[model samples]
Target: MELTSGWADPEPMAEGGIAGLSPYLQDRLEREAIPKSGKDALPPEQDRLLDQLLSAAFRE
Candidate 1:
């Protein structure tokens, strides 16, 4: 997916905001709670549906 803007956005981070966190803390915060189980965890059809939805939403 392409983002029109860079990752840095001031609006998302202000006083008492998530943006002010240290890099280590940010990494921790960004980590997914779910453990990966390789291909067994995801079906190929689900990925196809997600791709279709995103494509439709972002299409000109």
Candidate 2:
């Protein structure tokens, strides 16, 4: 996983997930501007996978 402080060039967290909240927030911000190519889009199961990843990543 990649971690960066700047918002300009945020890096990947997992295989496809972004490292920090910046990229995620940025994607959400420009969501409408971005095209739905349907290729990179995640399936519903991916959301659960992400939850598992995050939970594991931040486990105390």
Question: In model 1, how large is the Cα lDDT of residue 57?
Answer: 98
Off by over 4 Å in 2: 1-44
Taking all chains together, the TM-score of candidate 2 against the true structure is: 0.26
Tens digits of per-residue lDDT, candidate 2, 1-60, equal 777665677554323323223456446645656432334533336677688779889998
Candidate 1, lDDT over the whole model: 0.45
lDDT of 1 at 21: 31
lDDT of each: 0.45, 0.50
Taking every candidate in turn, the Cα RMSD to the unseen true structure, in Å, is 16.7, 13.7
In order of appearance, the predictions have TM-scores of 0.26, 0.26
The number of residue pairs in model 2 that clash at the backbone is 1
- The TM-score between candidate 1 and the true structure equals 0.26
